[model samples]
Target: MRLAVSALLLALVATPAAAHFQEILPSDDVLPEGGTVTIDLVFTHPMERGPTMDMARPARVGVMANGAVRDLTPAIEEKKVDGKSAWTLSDTLQEPGAAVYFVEPQPYWEQAEKKWITHYSKVIVDSYASGEGWDAMVGLPVEIEPLVRPTGLWTGNLFRGIVRNDGKPVPFAEIEVEWVNDGSVTTPNEAFITQVIKADGNGVFAYAMPHAGWWGFAALIDGPKTKAPDGSEADSELGGLIWVKASDMSAASKLLIKQ
Candidate 1:
């Protein structure tokens, strides 16, 4: 019994403190005047922001805006963050509407879990007061369809979405949430690093974000068995991630007219 207990303890100790997320953060989600938007692409444990992983050239990168999908792969440029491989791109906001940028990353070989991880991530940016397309689906393999407007959100707003896989709702799907820690906030323990929640019967989930910043909601599911880098069969983790930025209520201001 003691031997079995010791093995269990060892396994628990080896588990990661929190989950990983593929982050695609933009300068601003709402463009008051509409000009240019710079996007930062990185793969990391956002809350901890350490041990950054090298992201291979993404399999696909594009944007859906103005009722059309545009390939933005040519715009991707290499960047280095803290001496680790990263990517950056810029998109000019020429039209009025919502643009959804998405990335399908090449499967990452995680040696610790002996599984491949692929997160289909995306973020929405609204331009020039256009708000009609914020809820449009990008048709990723796995995705979270937002039930609320993604941008222009207050800090205490509740985020709601339906976890979908292959155009179908995944009932009782598991979701993991984390903030892009800018080093201002500190967590008390491992549990605070990643907040976990689940969808209901309709594959709908809700999370009330208490703080202001970019919050990532990832709907995780098991993908088809695939070969690892070593040519051996391994499990795959497919994450449907969506990023939303929340602004502080105190930031809103009342305009005074000159009498």
Candidate 2:
């Protein structure tokens, strides 16, 4: 009996546990200027620990350019994913050059709480040049597509979602889900579950929930868009939010199950 118990323990140890949070972006590279970029921040946390944990809070994202780090205050738009609340940050580059930027979640939790933790990401900025004659160049506006929220049900109390863009799916996009119980509204880093997911095909992706609750989801999509020189009409690369409910499936899924 002892040997059997030891074997079971070893098996459990071999299994990989879920991470606490993640960042979703289209690519590690960005343009130096004349473009806008959007990033989605997804967080996952435990709900059984009471409503003291709030996963909703405003965060500041910073970019590294030249030899110094610059704080990027993008326009944040809020949306709901599968009934959970989420937000997106959009910003534009104004300079021309190549540099790396770091995106970090700032002051998301109270100082009194030592359990609060933060995360970060690195972004590359490319040079932007335009002129006439031999140097005559056509510039494309950069736009990052949004990541799709996870869907479907599975055993082991796990839920997953995929991140995709412009009909094409990207692999290893950062994703984070935060569970904030039923009646709470705030952001506490201790209550976040984050992970990175790679796309399979047809722009598909997935992630596993630690348990379940009202989870706020977010992701980042980056790329370029083309426009007329007049700037009257143009095509935009899309980026936005995706939300999913684990406790309940969509009507389409329900219908299929009934069928």
Candidate 3:
């Protein structure tokens, strides 16, 4: 894998933290009327809501919809967040189906941990309420197969998925969860920043989102050990990341309390 020359070069010895999350966020996750959607590709600490990292030009970006794959690499535009490199892809939905947009980003050299990080991230957008393709696997090297439908989820709903490595279930995988914070919420401690969970014996993990907004689940595994940028040996970290949104239940769906 080609390492991103522009990744955040960690020269100083920083404190240990594991909140980096690769994001493939869309303007809208479910489009009932069908229109344009702008997807933002960012690498940051979503729960912290700041300190975005620079992301080099991705290796590949594409979408799977209507049983066909569409290469979207040429359409991605460079966008900066916190004065750091990022990307955005805008597309108009014309079909009544789910578009699974995914990206394979260039490997980032994390000098703090002395490892190479390669996170393959993806998100699903349902156009015109089409739910036929939300579960379609993009066949990523490391991927999360959604057991529960990923789209049109209500707030506080439980999400379930299986972590897979090369199309095979991982017996026990470590998954990190984080919610996209909009500055409206605050955490009392660092432990609340990134929620960590482990997959069951069969590689199935479940998370119930308590609030509304986008949630990211990343399953991490140790990749092949190789030489680092300095020609020294280092371990590689491979992550399979997926994002899903949840909305609050409408008041009409609530029942009146009989006083």
Candidate 4:
């Protein structure tokens, strides 16, 4: 029995982490000049900052600007990260309003977890300082409606949102948060890798970011049972993920140098 237990522990350590974050990250949250914005769509562990899984050609890639959706799938370009397949988009929003960018990637099969995962990820970019439409909803199957404006946030500001699935609130929904590591921070243990939290009784959750960088919030929900690779029934994990950037407001607190 001791030998069996030791083998089990070894197997557990060998297993890869299951905290998958689908990132739809923009180069800037608020575009001042109103032009092209670069977006990187990657599937990986943001905090771990490695092992980016290859994503298939997404089912949909588009943006909602000025109350209309524009299909940008034809403009998506394939890229490689850590020698793994990824994607990038250079979309141009020439108006003075907020543009909501979203991506629906193909279902990814995780052989280790024996399940299929699909994450509908989104991020907002306000162009020309036009704050209108910052709260536009993508109407995804599972999504987060931000209670506070996602942009123009400081490092310590609390980000709040309501977890919704099928246009209804999901009370006590689970959420996983991670900061896009800039290779400057290291985790002391496994628990620090992905910060986990749950929604309150009203389907609202909040998290105050501790650092200045891009942060990803993913709300995972069990989707309908789907067919596995081997024609067997398997669990489906549907995620509504959003990416937000926080800035360091030290400039506001700095003493001005005398001219």
Candidate 5:
């Protein structure tokens, strides 16, 4: 199963035709306080049409926190987006509480002169502190517990699952999904389906299926394979299968996965 999924992902190396530059990180309205946060930008183009042109020059990222602007050129990494080379910038969040940030392709640069630029993306920060004793008691400690949630009907097009780490809700973990239809398995890249969205600041994930039928949906979280004290690792096979029925989507469904 792992090999099949990996092959499917690798098949997506071809670049999409009409590339659209967008921000992929700092997507949440609230972020945990106190830690280095990395934001990534994703450039997407239409794969069905033709390849998007490679960026001739490097792009720039502009970061603003509490009315202070900082140039993020040093942390920029050049990489391929939808098969075309693109630029990415990563930045860290300091201090506590909420802040706003944005990213844009450098307009003054020679290459970005004629290219279309993306709108600014916003980010909100929430308090996250690490300590011990009474402070630890007030601070949110990591918990790895089972999650029980409703699947909202056996809609063959949807799969729902609960996520947790060390008995606590795991917010912000990535969830990748694939489906097995009849005797054929759909790869992540080949499957004409929407991406599985991870749970919010609370461990929860859901995805809509592409087709109706007896499909076996599998999920792999970018967490640890073995159980850990703090519940952090790339454990994909932790949460199991989710069954759905297209015709009976109106009926409420429930799912429970234990870690």
Candidate 6:
């Protein structure tokens, strides 16, 4: 019995750390004409795209567009993914400007890590050629204020953002990046599962995504110490996550270009 217990402990330690990302994916990040946009909120290992966890009702859900902020929490609906709870909503972008949607998810208890995770996730959507307000800050506890516009991105463009906590730059912040794998690509090793990077002295980091798909950037930071439901003291992981989708340049379209 002792030998079996020891083997169990060893196996637990050998398991790869799965990176958790809160995703606020939209049907279309850019709506040329003012229309409805559907958003999906889920807590999952996005890179692998399975084993989704139950996401409790978000503490707050809102959008900032055309210099105005509106609470959207009341419209969110509960759903299930992989037998786990998720949330979904729809919003109409009537104004012609960049709409920034933000969510503050309820703390999630992670059994394997023995901690609670809370991610403040946001995404930017553009409408009607109005290229303004893409970098507006919604005052999340932790947030990535984009230095470059988040929308209308090409696959090879460099994405830049400054990691901030309480409106102050967090120097040397650690960020984990992953591209949602559609099973079209494979990773040979564990290192390729999540690409890690650190912010420079100014709390700014940039990464150029190589593939044409949804990419998630998660800035991890230690948050207020909290306790688990089991009455055990546990650490809190606060993640400021942003999701961006890059589009590929079609070869046929390129060949037909007048230039």
- CA shift of 64, model 3, Å: 0.4
At residue 103, candidate 2 shows an lDDT of 41
Of 5 and 6, the candidate ahead on lDDT is 6
Local distance difference test, candidate 1:
0.92
- Tens digits of lDDT, candidate 5, 1-259: 9999888878655432222323334423233455566554543322222234455443445554545556676777878756876666545666554333334333211132222232222223333421111101101122112122111124444445444434455676555333323334343553343234566676666666554332222232332344323443322223322222232433222222221
- TM agreement with the true structure for every prediction: 0.92, 0.33, 0.90, 0.93, 0.34, 0.93
Stretches of candidate 3 exceeding 4 Å from the true structure: 1-15, 250-259
What tens-digit string does per-residue lDDT give for candidate 1 at 148-225? 999999999999999999989999999999999999989997779999999999999999999989999999999999
Higher-scoring candidate on lDDT, 2 or 4? 4
Query: Candidate 6, clashing residue pairs?
Result: none
Please, what are the lDDT tens digits per residue for candidate 4 over residues 1-58? 9999999999898765659999899989998889989999999988989779999999
For residues 1-259, write the lDDT of model 3, one tens digit per residue: 1344324334222334657899999998989988999999999999988688899999999999988889999999998899999999899898899999999999998877889999999999999988878889999999999998899998989999999999999988999999999888899977788899999999999999988899999999999999898899999999999999998776425543332
Predicted candidate 6, C-alpha RMSD: 2.8
Worst 10 residues of 2 by lDDT: 131-140
Candidate 1 vs 3: which has more TM-score: 1
Deviation from native of the Cα of residue 181 in model 1, angstroms: 0.5
Q: What are the RMSDs of all candidates, in order?
A: 3.5, 17.9, 7.2, 2.7, 19.3, 2.8
Candidate 5: segments with Cα more than 4 A from true spot: 1-21, 27-30, 45-59, 106-122, 125-259
> Model 2, which residues run further than 4 Å from truth?
1-15, 24-34, 44-55, 106-116, 127-259
Top lDDT model: 1
User: Per-residue lDDT tens digits of candidate 2, residues 1-259?
Assistant: 9999999999778744433433334222334344766655444333322212233644655554445555654655665544555556665556664433334444233233222344333333343522111111111111122232122222224444444443344565544444535545333543343434544554344555543333434444433344434554333322223333344335546878899
> C-alpha displacement of 61 in model 5, angstroms?
1.4
Which regions in candidate 4 have their CA more than 4 angstroms from the true location?
A: 1-8, 11-16, 251-259
lDDT winner, 2 or 6: 6
